[model samples]
Target: MSLSVWVPIVGLLTLGALFALFSVGIAPIVGPKRFNRAKLEAYECGIEPSPQPVGGGRFPIKFYLTAMLFIIFDIEIIFLFPWAVHFDALGLFGFVEMVLFIGMVSIAYAYEWRRGGLDWD
Candidate 1:
């Protein structure tokens, strides 16, 4: 491989780095400095902040369960994209393996559904 081929890639990387640095460096000076009680407080998806327990209270298990479900499905998609793109090359073996993988994922989905893990209320 010739070092000349890497010139554009290195140039693009340096340009990206400079752009990110410039945006962050200029933000404080350009952005509003106004701070109020509401602005300073931690915000949650437009819901009013609840009072904290005198001692830090335990978080609801549902919150963790929902987060876990998101991660599980998100990882499933990551695997699926590569398999789909290579479908022609992988042929029958890949098809069977993906079917089995999807079957397992479906079982987990069904189990969560039965357990009310998907419910918001």
Candidate 2:
């Protein structure tokens, strides 16, 4: 690349570094120094942290499986969106491929449904 191209990159890097330095240096002097039980305690998913159970509060296997299923379906949509955006360029072969992918996913979904993978309780 040319020197002109590098100028903006270097300028942005310097700007980021200056911002980080300023935030870190000024925060200690300007920001709140409060430390108390409520502020220090962990908060997650808008819920207060509960007392730990025995055996380190093991979550159910169903919870992990549901999370994985959500991620897998989410990724499938991510793949489909690009193909849909380029539908005309991809033509018939892409259409067939997408159909097959959906068929497989449908089968998986049906299997899971049959096995009660989608049940809440």
Over 4 Å off in model 1, which ranges? 43-56
User: TM-scores of all models?
Assistant: 0.79, 0.61
- For candidate 2, what is the TM-score? 0.61
| lDDT over C-alpha atoms for residue 37 of model 1 | 98
Model 1, range 1-121, lDDT digits (tens) per residue?
9999999999999999999999999999999999999888987543457787423665666766777788769978998999999999999999999999999888878877776789987
Which pairs clash in model 2? none
Residue 112, model 2: Cα distance from true site in angstroms: 6.6
Q: List all candidate RMSDs to the true structure.
A: 2.8, 4.0
What is the C-alpha local distance difference test score of each model? 0.84, 0.81
- Give the alpha carbon lDDT tens digit for every residue of 88-121 in model 2: 9999999999999898888877866776678875
Q: Where in model 2 is the C-alpha error above 4 Å?
A: 42-57, 106-121
Model 2 poorest ten-residue lDDT run: 45-54
Indicate the residue-level lDDT of 85 in model 2.
96
86 Cα displacement, candidate 2 (Å): 1.5
